[model samples]
Target: MTEPILPRIRPEIAALAPYKQGRQAGPDAFKLSSNENPFDPLPSVVSALQSATPINRYPDAAATRLRERLASRYGVGSDQVHVASGSVAILYQLVQAVASVGDEVIYAWRSFEAYPGLPLVAGATGIPVPLTEDSRHDLDAMADAVTERTRAILVCTPNNPTGPIVTSAEFEAFVARVPADVLIILDEAYAEFVTAEDAVDGLAERVYEQHPNVVVLRTFSKAYGLAGLRVGYAIGHTAVLNAARATGIPLSVTAAAETAALASLDAEAELLQRVAVLVERRTTVIAALRAQGWDVPDSQANFVWLPTGERTDEVAAVFLDADIVVRPFSGDGIRISVGEHESVEKVLQAAQSVVERRQ
Candidate 1:
C-alpha cells in the first residue's frame, strides 16, 4: 500500500510551537516560575465555588451576572464588558476579530510571552519591537513600526517575564502618534500588583472614552488568586467587544469561574491586603538582588527579571540547586516570581551564588 499523505496544514500554523508554561517544581522546591499569587483563595471565593454546583448544565454562554457586576464596578454599560475564561482568552478573541492573513499586530518584544504567538494564530504577522535597556516597552519605536497593514497593538503594562510598566505619559504620547482606527489593547493582567505611582491604570484613565479603539483587559488570576477558575474581562466599546464575542467559543466562561470572580470582588479589600504583602516581598527581593550586584529590573508586578544573558541557564541551575524553581528564557534572562516569604531568602542565596560564580 502507498504511504498516506499528511493532512494539509497552514505553514505558519505548522511552524508555531505550543505555549509552554513554567516547569512544575517538586514538593520540596519552591515553584517560582509562574507569577501566581502565593496566597490561597479567600473563604468567600471557596464558598462561592462550592455553591456553583450545576456542572451537569452548561454555563451561561453570555456570563451575564459576572459581566453585570464588572460593568457596575467599572461604571461601564453591560455591553461594554465582555467575559471570558481568562484575559488571555479575550486576547485571542480580540485578535481573531480584528486580524487575518496579511495584517500585522504590534507588541513589545520580551513582553508577555503570549503576545508574539497570538498574532500567528490569527494568521497575522507579529511585529515585536525590542524593549528599552530598562526592560520596558519602547513605545516610540513601537509607534514607528506601525504600517497600513497594522490592525492591532498589545501594550502589556508591568510586562510579563520582565516586570517593568509602561507609564501613563509615555502611553498617551505614543497613542497620539498611532492612527485612530487601529485597535489598542491594554493588557493589565498584573494591574492590581502595581504600586508605582506613575504606572498606567487603563480603566482609571478611561482610555476608551477618549480612544474608542482601545480596550482594557484585566483578570481575576493574578490578584484575586483565581488562576484555577480562569475568569477575566475586557472593557471597550460594545461594537469592538461584539466583534470579539462573535469569534469566541460559547460557554467558555464556566459558572464556577463567574461565581468565584464575583466572590473575589466582594472580598476585594482582603485580597488587596494579600497583594500588599506580595508587593512588599517583591521590593525586598529586588533590593536584595541589586545589593548582590544583579541588574534586576524595577518590578511593579509580582515577579522580577534578571538579565542573566548567556548565563541564564547557569544561574537558573544555581536557583534549582537551592530548591527554588524559576522561569529562564534561554539566552535572555530569568523571571522569578515573589512566592512564599520563606522562599525570599532562598532566592537571595541563589542570586549571591550566581554573583560569586561570575567573579
Candidate 2:
C-alpha cells in the first residue's frame, strides 16, 4: 500500500497515545476499575439536571454561577476561581499556560496517568520523580529535581493508583524549596474522601495566600457523583486563571453540568453523608486487604492499591473471572475502587484466590 500523505503534526504529539480510561464491565459484573463513586446521584442533583433545558442556547462560557458559588465556599474572589469541564481540563490549561517547548513539568510517577500527557501536550518535557517504597510522593526528591527549565510541578494528594498523601508539613517544606516563580498545581480530586488529619488541605490551609504560584484543582466528579457531567474548578491567582481561561475551549461547561454542580453544593450536607459512607467502605476494604497479607498501601482515597507486581495481569484475570473488573497496570499492580457494598465480598473472594495461588 502506498504511504498516505499526512498533515504536518508535531512529532511528539504524533507519538503520543490518547488517554485510556478504565474498562467497562459486563452488566452482571461490578466495575471497580475507575475510582468512581458507586452511589447514584443525589435527588437534588437529579432534579437540577431534569429542570435544565433549552440546550438550544450556548452555555455561559464563563461558568459564572458555578465559579461564584465555589468562590464563596473557598473564600476566594470569583475572578480567582476558574471552572472547566473537569479538573483534568484545568490541568491541561494550567500546563499550557506555564510550560512549553523545552520547559519541564515535574510530578510523581505512578500518579494520575494524565500527568505525563499534560506536559507532552504543551510541547514540554515531563520530569517524573518516582514514588517512595510506600507509594507516597517523595517531596524532597521532587524538590531536588527542579531546575531553571522547570516551569510547573503537579502534586496529586492521596496520590492516585498508589494511594498515599503528602502531609501538610512535607508540602510546606517542599514549597519552601521550590522557587516562588515555579507554578505548583495541587490536584485534589479525592480530597473529600481523605480521613487523615495531617493530609494537606489546599483550601483550608490557605496555601494560595502564602504562595501565589500555587493553584488548587478540584472536581465535583468523585465525591459529588458528577463524573458524567464533567464539572471541575480551580482556585488560584486571577492572573494565572485568566491565562488558563484564554487557552481553554470556550463554553465547554454545559448548563446541565453547572446546574448539577450548584445543586450538589446546595445539598452538600446530604451529599457529604454519601461520601462518609464511601469512606467507611474504603476503611473496611483496606483493613480486609491488609489482613489478607497483601502489601496494600494506606489509602485515604476511595480506592486501594494492590501491588501485585509481575503477577499484575494474572491477578487481574482472576478478578475478571469472578465478575469483578479492576484497573490493572501491566507490570505494576491493580487499583480497586471501593464500590457497591455487595461487591466487597466478591472482591475479597477474588483476592483470596490470588493469595491461594501464590501459596
Which has the greatest lDDT? Answer: 2
lDDT of 1 by residue, 1-359 (tens): 99999999999889888888999999999999989898988887898889994999998899999999988998999999999999999999999899999999999988888888889999999999999998989999999999999999999998998999989999899889999999999999999999889999999999998999999999998989998889999999999999999999998999999989988989999999999999999999999899999898889999999999898898899999999999999899999999999999989988998789779
TM-score each candidate: 0.98, 0.99
In model 2, pairs of residues that clash are none
Each model's lDDT? 0.92, 0.93
Candidate 2 per-residue lDDT over residues 1-359, each given as its tens digit: 99999999999889988988999999999999988889888877888888885699888999999888888988989999999999999999999999999999999998999899999999999999999999999999999999999999999998998889889999999999999999999999999999899999998998998999999989999999899989999998999999999999999999999999999999999988989999999898888888999999999999999998898999999999999999999888999999999999999999988888889
Give the C-alpha lDDT of model 1: 0.92
State candidate 1's TM-score: 0.98
Please list the residue runs of candidate 2 whose C-alpha ends up more than 4 Å from where it truly belongs after superposition. Answer: none
